[model samples]
Target: MIRHIVLFKFKPGISWDDPRALEAEGMAAKVGGEVPDLQEWSTGRNISTRPIAYDFAVIGLLEDEAALDRYLVHPFHQEAIRRWREISEWVIADLEE
Candidate 1:
């Protein structure tokens, strides 16, 4: 399986309560059940207060690279990305498990 991880950092002045952030969170929360290729999906606001910590996280498990590719391009995922882009910047990693 492939472990897909994303860490998002809100832009200056953006907060979790922002409407766009909420919309992005809602869209991402639905991806696990909506995408066939996604074996698992979990996303949420970061709880750590450490300075290095990001604002949010998204973790997904997929069967393989192909499945990971499909999940990345899925319409629901794309929409979530779009919403997130409006409020934050993110970094991602994909690893074999």
Candidate 2:
């Protein structure tokens, strides 16, 4: 299964230039470590784009939907998301395929 994660609308002025933002993404990526089913992980902070809906995009390929859910509720994910929420606003969607 392919799971796409996009996070949008950070607090105004939080740019990719911010070291904190960069570190946050790095930490978020680490969440994949806890889930063995994640076949591939791709993530990035938007560099330059016109009218992009999100500030970041993280894509995960997993063995199955259950593994995707594990990725969502993973302890590292909870920790990383908690930290992100403290710094910015966000919205996400799960595309099932």
Candidate 3:
């Protein structure tokens, strides 16, 4: 399986990020069915309580390298990423497991 991880920190003065989180999570919930080659997907938003770890994280489990590449170039994922970039700072890592 391919595991895709992302961490995000919201930009100052941006408050719509919760909706972004919801949207991302919602989309992720639908991935395995709508998009081929996905095994599972999940996303989480940061709570107001502070933690030493990175802000928010998203975890996606996919079928293989090709599926991961498909996710990378998928239009829906691209759109979500564009929206995310507008709202926050982020870091991403994709791993094989």
Q: Give all candidate RMSDs, comma-separated.
A: 0.9, 2.2, 2.8
lDDT of each: 0.89, 0.72, 0.71
User: Mind giving the per-residue lDDT tens digits that candidate 3 earns over 1-97?
Assistant: 8788888777776554468755655664555466565677676766766745555677788888888888888877777777678667888888888
Model 2 misplacement above 4 A: none
Residue-level lDDT of model 1, residues 1-97, one tens digit each, is: 9999999999999987788888888888998988899878898889999988899998999999889888889898888888989999899999998
TM-score of each: 0.94, 0.75, 0.73
- Highest lDDT model number: 1
Point to the candidate with the largest TM-score.
1
Candidate 1 vs candidate 2: the TM-score winner is 1
TM-score, cand. 3: 0.73
Misplaced by over 4 Å in model 1 are none
The CA lDDT at 58 in model 2 is 69
Q: Where does candidate 2 clash, by residue pair?
A: none
lDDT of 3 at 23: 65
lDDT against true structure, model 1 = 0.89
Indicate the residue-level lDDT of 84 in model 1.
88
Q: Return whichever of 2 and 3 wins on lDDT.
A: 2
